[model samples]
Target chain A: MALSPDDVARLARLARIDLSQAELEHLAPQLDVILESVAEVSKVAADDVKPTSHAIEIANVFREDEVRPSFTAQQALSGAPVKESGRFRVPQILQEDE
Target chain B: MSGLVLQTAADLAGLIAAGEVSAHEVVAAHFERIAQVEPQVQAFLALDEERALAAADRVDAKLAAGEKLGPLAGVPLGLKDIFTYQGLPCTVGSRILEGWHPPYDATVVKRLLDADLIIVGKVNMDEFAMGSSTESSAYKVTHNPWNLDYIPGGSSGGSAAALAAFEVALSVGTDTGGSIRQPAAVNSLVGVKPTYGSNSRFGVVAMASSLDVPGPFGRTVLDAALLHEAISGYDPMDSTSLNLPIPPVAQAARSGEIKGYRIGVVKELGGEGYAPGVLQRFNESLALLESAGAEIAEISCPHFTYALGAYYLIMPSEVSSNLARFDAMRYGIRVGDDGKRSAEEVMNLTRGAGFGAEVKRRVIIGTYALSAGYYDAYYGSALKVRTLIQQDFDAAFAKVDVLVSPTSPTTAWKIGERLDDPLAMYKADLCTIPANLAGICAASIPVGLSSENGLPVGFQIMAPAMADDRLYRVGAALERGVADAFGGPVLNQLIGSPAWDALSAQAVAARFPNIILGLAENLS
Candidate 1:
């Protein structure tokens, strides 16, 4: 339950959010306290108690592969920040020099 | 026609259907009222005048053709910004998705149009429904209609405020850990969180997917129930959406008979940290229910106390996962992608620049909780605790038909009072999170002004999943039982009537002083 700033920074990197040093300092303690408080769950979380991933029971919804009405390609690309040739455009995934 | 803005959805729908008032006029009246009070309330993120009037025209056309109208037809409704509505900026109160326009409608949005309700505008909320106060919004903070100085409880703050200010007759909001009910509690509006899967979430932006369920808000119990019925039905698009018949909520609301129905007072949700005035109003509401022929008893749900801890763990864990979609490649704003940084680096920078502090805090916590080595201790145990909480509800429901509690621990605080203290703010939903954990239905109906601060207090009611109508049934009876003493629901008198204009912010507290009895005495 004790979350250090370094621990938070590592998690932030994993979560794909680049947190500044200032945010790490400020939020780490807040998150640490939150964790310590939530850690109280360990007191009653006996192994006998089954875990509930969802409150309401639902099964994997299967459907036929039939085509249904959906967003047109034009509509699909409408909200894209960068697009070309009817596809989303992104920054370099691989460095050419490398 | 001039008093159209003040009329309930039921009244407006009746008038529109009976040809007493044109649907266009009704929509116009609400828009005009929005123009007047919106500056002070700051409830809306965007106003769609063109879309609203067009929808109104369609309703009018149906009437002209002598075709049957949909239920709640032509009534203006405020929508929470999280729901996708094509052609409007759906911010979800976050800067990351600022100016993002969804190309399609959420299933709930489509259903609202099908029901012939006019969508006035998108209302503000806590950024992605994370915070207790509306102050966390990237846009303006929504003020409570009862007192402009205090925070209207959030993350459904603006949805509650818009209706409470009478800008719209009905509004829609989603509750993930009491967003709808808490705001409804402080604003003196009726809000419902229908049973999980009872309503469709196909187009609602995901926030803690397991817990988030879109719901309805109104000035009265019946109005909320009527809106509830219109929006709730099975949709194949949502795997969790129950393929079952809609509960007869409006019918139950109309029948104010809870004779011999057993109600339980939740032992965990009250006392200790609860505000004295909030408890006073809750106790008074219990007396009303008792007099209305409902049997009441104290029911112990011991695991309920740990609901807040489990919710913070579960909700943010889901937030971290669900929000991973905003990678800046597909849609929304992309920052620092100036052809130099790699895609991963750009995604990190864009998210950092785009998200607010609260959003970052939650995502990081979610990441940490779901991370290996910590998953069993944090996330897994929270899941186990969730099972215990549901079991607690199951045992309680066996002895009682429904349970009651104060919707929120305290009335609305000042705008910035608890913002810095995240844990302090999280406690606002203390009494309401248990129902979400159990996936059961819950509602908050206006009781009266808290004696200490004079802010509105709401009485919380809970029913087993799929039995949502019971919340309406008991809420109606209690509302009727207490109606005469306060001259009506205090909310109806202060905001839902034409005379409300004179009771604006400062005037209301100075004029009424005591709860509604003082106003009733003055009116007499």
Candidate 2:
């Protein structure tokens, strides 16, 4: 249950949040304690019991296939930190090719 | 006559409807109060004075036109920042979304407007509703109205503090675990977390999709019920929204009868680790309920002990997924987007800078839990424990009409008491988490003050899902019984407290120095 700094770093990377070396070190022990404490869940979770994702049962809802009034492009882009031509502008994903 | 700002939501509604008070006057009174006390309480993150007055004017105009007003017409409400209000900043208490004005109103916000409740302002919260205390708010700390040094329990602390401080009679709050109820408990107000999915989460800033529920906070049970009725119902926008009629909670509150009702005390929630005064008040409330003809029994919810463990895992797992949408591109603060860095790198940098330490800790924990190899042992096991907790509720509810416990283990602690210890902070929600895990409705009403610290303690009443009315009935009955014993509401005791007087004087001096010599003088 001991979470290593490497594990903390990996988790931060997977979660898409950058962490400093100090944060990783500080969080590793705390996370290890939390994980060990929460690991109690495994002790009582019998195999026969079904895992519940939602508290109540919900089926996929369907609406008629028709156009509806929704957020306009302007509204959608209103809160975007970076926008270009009414679309979210993210940094380049592809590398330059020869 | 009581000042308009100090009047309960029900009384304000009545005054407005009877033409004894104008909505404009009520809104203005609250703004004055906010101006006087907000410096110390730090309850609000944003206040739209112009919009609030404009909204109030429309209510008055409607009344003048002889139009029927809703139950909460003309009442000002403090909206927790987690919900989107069109053209209003919805930070959800994070630096990432700071100053970001949402383009649309949340379903609940629209509903509140339709009910004619004026939005006073957006209140503060724990960052993304992640913490038990409001200390995690990136903006500012919200001090308890009773004692400036103690926390106004959170992550709905600001909403509860606003009510306790007489800044607003009603407010909206969200409870992922016990955000609304815990804050309500410590502040001696009524907080209700309705049945999961009973209220739409369409425009709410999602923390844990399954656990997050927007609820109401009021100075009285009836007030909370009235606000709950106004803001809750089915909505197509939220897939998980329950397709059912809104329960008659307000009616139940008015009736306030618990005759022939079987109320069970969950043996697991009390004793050991609970403050003596909290247990004392809880026992007193139970005795009162029994005197009012409620059949009390001891019920053992064996699996509830694992509830906190399961909730931390499941909540963070959902949080990690839900917050993944907060990448630098789509919204809020963006860092290092000079076009040279990759999107992923920018996203990482932005999130690291944007999220607070607690939020980051949860994301890391959740990432680890839902990671490839550990998924089954962590998230999967937690979900199964959730099932076990639900089964516990099912069995208990089968034997009783409602379950009762102290809302929180202790009264409001000092602000920095548990900030360094996350585990200690997490334990604050132990008694309230079962209801959320079971998707049932639960309410916290002021029972009495804790003898240990002289702060407020709350008695919790929980009912089965969709049977939300039962919670109101039990809460209203207990509220009546306690109020009768105290000769008034429990929070009325704070009126003469030296802490309140000192805090009020400080707040008044800090901001409204031109006004009365002492703001607490006017308050009393």
Candidate 2 root-mean-square deviation in Å: 4.8
Best by lDDT: 2
lDDT of each: 0.88, 0.89
Per-residue alpha-carbon lDDT of model 1 for B51-141, expressed as tens digits? 7889899999989999998769999999999999987778888877876778999999999988999998889999999988888898788
Off by over 4 Å in 2: B507-524
Clashing pairs in 2: none
DockQ of each: 0.85, 0.82
Model 2 Cα lDDT, one tens digit per residue, A1-98: 57899989988998999899999999899889899999999999888989999888888887789988888889889878768877888898876761
In the range B1-524, model 2's lDDT, one tens digit per residue, is: 13787788999999999999999999988888887778888888888888888999999999999999899999999999899987677788898886677888899999999999999888889999988889999889999989989999999999999989888879999988999999999999999999999999989999999988999999988999999999999999998999899889999999988889999999999999999999999999999999999999999999999999999899999999999989877778888777688888888998988899999989988988998988999999999999999999999989999999999999999999999789999999999998888889999999989989899999888999999999899898999999899999998898777866755674452333221111111100
Q: Taking the true A–B contacts (Cα pairs closer than 8 Å), what share appears in each candidate?
A: 0.86, 0.87
For candidate 2 chain A, which ten residues in a row score worst on lDDT?
A: A89-98
Worst 10 residues of 1 chain B by lDDT: B515-524
Measured with DockQ on alpha carbons, how good is candidate 2?
0.82
- For candidate 1, list the clashing residue pairs, or say none: none
